[model samples]
Target: MQESVQHKGVTHFTIVKILRTFSPDEMNEFEKFLHSPFFNNHSTILRLYKELKKFYPLFSDKCLTKEHLFSVANKGKSYDDQLLRKYLSRITKLAEEYLSILQMRTEGIRKDYNVLLQLSRRNIKEIYTRKIKKVEKRFNNFQQFEAEHILHKHFFSALKYELLNKDNQIKPHNELLVDSINNLLDYFLIVSGWLLNEIESHSYTYDTGSKRNAVVAPIDRNMIVEFVENAISNLHSEDKDRMIFLEMVLNDMKLSSPESGFSAYTNLKKLVYGNSHKMSRQILQFYLQRMNVYCLLENLRGTHDMHLDLFQNYRKLLEENLFGSEGKTNLRFLEFRGILISALKIKEFEWAEKFINENVKYVDEDLQANVFHYGYSLLRFYTQDYSESLSHNSKIQSGLLPITIDSYILKAKIFYVLGHSDSALSLADSFRHFINLNKLISDFHKQNLLNFLKYFRAIIRLKAKNNIAKAGKLLAELQTSSNTREKKWLIEMTEDLLKLK
Candidate 1:
């Protein structure tokens, strides 16, 4: 008769003892057993463990760590080795649980598996068709860049898993996969730094304004193009990958040499085109941020064509994501207002008015005030509707957060537009006093105020039909001192006004 028996998990001593007792042939047999498909069943493996424990009394142990068991289970080669057997048992249990969960559609596992399967198929196709391999070989000179491409692909894989398994109950395993992907991304960052150093060294040739001609070999533009293209391709693979790629590309663009226009434009175009979506608001958000940087850089370099291209891209994005039926989110609305304001500053009135009318109701009180003020001010000066413009200006003045120098400037401009030369001159005088009293204007704004005062003063003189030559002199002085495109545009408008008089 069999005596009543109890079985416990394997301990370290039991594992060591089992290893010692196993002959080489027995160990080989055990390894085969551990690796066999028979060990894949969770309940069967647990039952076998209990049965073996009752008969042998050799596997009992209370102090075994899960990690140790996992190691032994994955690497053990002999069925006779108790430690290896126990690990196999544990793995079988885990896989069984995973399979059962998958079968049951529990916690969205069923849906996740479907998406995962599709993504896996796509990955296989990409790999088999040599798309990935081609990219890998194309940027061989920039290993870091190639590594980034690989890392982006891995990140997309992880993201697919995350989106598909979003509601899975087994968070620990999901987190482990996520951590592994992040580790790969970190490795890519290191590689990217190395590549950046190489590129910088190769492109170091620049004149320092000295008689000595310094010549540093420029990096191959073709290689840079290929790197950017790979990054864009990887980014378009998935949402998560796109965000990471855009952030890296934007940072690089910010630091890139002015001469790297092709690279900058390529990355910018990818960002604009690849993320044309309304569901994922982040796509538009990133697009706007990148456009802001691109536009500012182009404007600074006096590349009006490039600046206009960037602006038009932003306009299209606004039209698609902000005004379209898919538009949502307060942040996007605010961003739309900001973009429209920027367009107005460049005198793109048609675009500005179209955006304003479409987005009028969505604008908050403050933004509405500014939009009305800007639109009416332009209409007043250009269309000779001074009274209507002043009425809109009053609305803005009332809605302002607080009285600031900008408000005073707006008031002065309204007075000038309304042909109230005395009022405009008086408002300008008050602005000068306010600036001296509070020093609220930044240095940049100080320059802007000087230009504004000169222009408004000239306009007041012209309106009064007094000192025409003095107005002309003032216009020349303002034009000479103006250092910005917008200021120059205003100066040209003033010249047209003088000609009309």
Candidate 2:
């Protein structure tokens, strides 16, 4: 049956929005959550839940109208909008509670700490001590020294000190107090360093764009850097704490000065791999990702060639299975593209194909086909299979700004390479207009893409006329210009044009 127009309000309801976000498994879990008497006792809400669930993800059924919902929920009664709203508001609250509960389930250490605090308040000595020992054992067995671990360690140490002090019969252990304080300081220092690094990076990213109105941060970043550096200098390089401090400093260096970015990146990479054994999987992933970002920016700056090195680091990440966190098997779309682009940049066609085929399943189900097609499009283009490349490129849909823009560039390049100059030029004009009109894209990205289109159109027109002299001039202009995206592709195209008789 066609959905009733009257049901539009219900379809666009807030509860419907919340429910649509739930996966099939999450839907089942939410049903179970509602069934719990402690969570929902009203029979009317249960009836409403049954009615609403029938529509599920697409709550557009004609029977899904508000009046129908009212009849189903409160049988043998006249429709009442206020009462229906009340039930909906309650269910929405319950759905929100379920979300919080889901998040809480993932935070095992936080939950344990909460239990420990409550037990201490109740002075449940035996059980609290047992819980402490259990958690301590878990921590001891835990190899991942990520932020959570450090925070939990501090919590455990401080609680241990408090517990000892609570006992009047025993002397307060000064050693435990000292240990707690040190852990606390370590947590502060590590967290502060990372935050400062982000601040330093943000300043470079936003401030350098001429069109962007940069927001000055309130605090002096230099003072924070200075304090962190001074504290880190006291610790040896072998110490895990010192490694994080150095990583943050290097991260700042990579962003602060373009001249020294590559040098900083190399040293930061050494720090990461050198202490890979001592560090947790999460920390390794973090630093590797940071290094990749530096490489990407430096390469985009058109001052360095970090493409192959970035690809190699991605290989290391893939080898170590550091792309996903514990229990998270899905590869993010951006990470998938990052790996694909890095491989394609170095013309590793076979490797790129293998990665796409093997790992496409790890992308979100909805994005699997489009992501696969996009990767293959680039791969085919790099291999000079223009027809096959366009075939794959045409399969790409308008989603994900980066993928959409890349597919546009890919399709235009395929047309250009296959001697379809008119089509390439037409597409370049439309793409230039699209880039200018897009508001979500940053000014920096807009300028870069516009630069790509400008050079792209020139290359196509020059190649079509067989103007070798002008193409040579354009090639030099491109080489000296710093504001271009796809610098490598444009350079190669211009160089190819020069070779044509």
Candidate 3:
């Protein structure tokens, strides 16, 4: 598990991995752990440790070959793979055990709780009782305001009760712990129901109009709906700062009556505005991400006024460093791309340009250029600066499936808008060929994009001669197929075409 990927034939991974993560003091302690007869009786494990120690921090294969280790382990005897594997496994096992114990020893609560349990086993009743109380006292001094903190406290308290029960006379104070655990569970399930609702709604929205939505009652649909609705009016019943209740309400509104989603969004904004500092970074990111999702649903339902507001929210959160690293991660360029699009959709052209230029330093150096060019190209296209868009398009050289697909489609869109119908159709055919030949994309994405390209080529050719109604009809068939990229855009395009006609 420590190795990033499995090297099936490479036997050095287990031992090299152990050494790679060790701190200097930890490595020293591990040396002692290796020498101890209690932990290891074989001297060959020590030999392996000493040999592996020479390459600590960067345990590359140059000096770490299995055959070399076998020679060192068996005193230059004939190389034996089985003998080599046996000692390697033995050393790796001891290294893993040592780290586990070391981690336990460094954690105050766990270390102390373990000692108390050991004392209980020794029948040292007075010391065990005192130590248990001390452990409880220490845990009490912790900041147990969050649900996770309370849950962990409850877990430890229950474990203490289990240990105490082994001696029929001893008992731990676990009644309040049980209460806390139940309350925490209640909070998690209710808040987590929002996540479940979102997953189901995407499927639901496919059947209904993106304009219509309702909360599908969860298994306990009535209670959950009532509890979520009541929590909005009675925020005091649960601390919004620690529990994710407002997001739950938002999800409920998005499902139950998305016409009410904007109201729920307002409620969420107020709650987040008041409690952003009280929330942890992870929680804040989560709240903002849900708001982004709410904004997305609103956009799908044709709420464009809030676009700038949501764009400003992205800037505000990015300014405050509230977004998680993944929002800016180069690995998932799509998320970062969404942020750029948010700014672009609101017509924050300068801000989007500035962001692409300034924020790319956070991306992996290898990927920064690719992300920037892909994003800049879309920004240019959306702003209708077709030549600049084409420049950015030429600069894109990324092989990532999402980046590649968007780049190809963006070039097609630009050519269509620029009255280069011949170029657009040519690009679509080439893009289709490239997609078919490439295995990097999933079949689902491949099919959707291919379908989109087909319709796009048809629509582009038809619309050039003021046959806008024909273009609109071409897209109406798409409404029944599983939705593809730019469904809302297609709908809006169809509506706009019909308007012109």
lDDT of each: 0.50, 0.79, 0.67
Residue-wise lDDT of candidate 3 within 239-335, one digit each (tens)? 5433454454445444345456667667777776676656545556666766776565555334434576577567656866764452443334655
* Residue-wise C-alpha lDDT for candidate 1, range 45-162, written one tens digit per residue: 4443333333233444453433334434344442334554555546445444544543465323234434545645665544333433343244243322234344544554465455
Full candidate order by lDDT, most accurate first? 2, 3, 1
Per candidate, the number of residue pairs that clash is 5, 0, 3
Order of candidates by TM-score, top first?
Answer: 2, 3, 1
User: Which should have the higher lDDT, number 2 or number 3?
Assistant: 2
Evaluated at residue 72, the lDDT of candidate 1 is 40
User: Which pairs clash inside model 3?
Assistant: 214-255, 215-255, 215-256
TM-score result, candidate 3 = 0.68
What alpha-carbon RMSD in Å does predicted model 3 have with respect to the real structure?
7.2
Task: Superpose all Cα atoms of candidate 1 onto the true structure and report the RMSD in Å to 1 decimal.
Answer: 20.9
**Candidate 3: segments with Cα more than 4 A from true spot:** 1-42, 56-63, 98-147, 156-178, 187-191, 194-223, 227-259, 297-331, 347-369, 379-399, 426-459, 467-501
- Model 2: per-residue lDDT, tens digit, 1-501? 334543445866889999988888888888888899999998888788878888888887766788889999988998777898999999999999999998999899889999999999999999999999999898878765566777778888888878877876477687766667656765665566566557655544442444356555554545655655666776665776545645555454445455666676777777677667767676677677767777776677677788998898899899888866655567988789889999998888889999999999999899999998888888988888888888988888857888888888888888887788989989898898888777667666677788888899888888878999999999999998875788988999999988886
Point to the candidate with the largest lDDT: 2
TM-score of 1: 0.44
Query: Could you tell me how far off, in angstroms, the CA of residue 206 lies in candidate 3 after the best superposition?
Result: 14
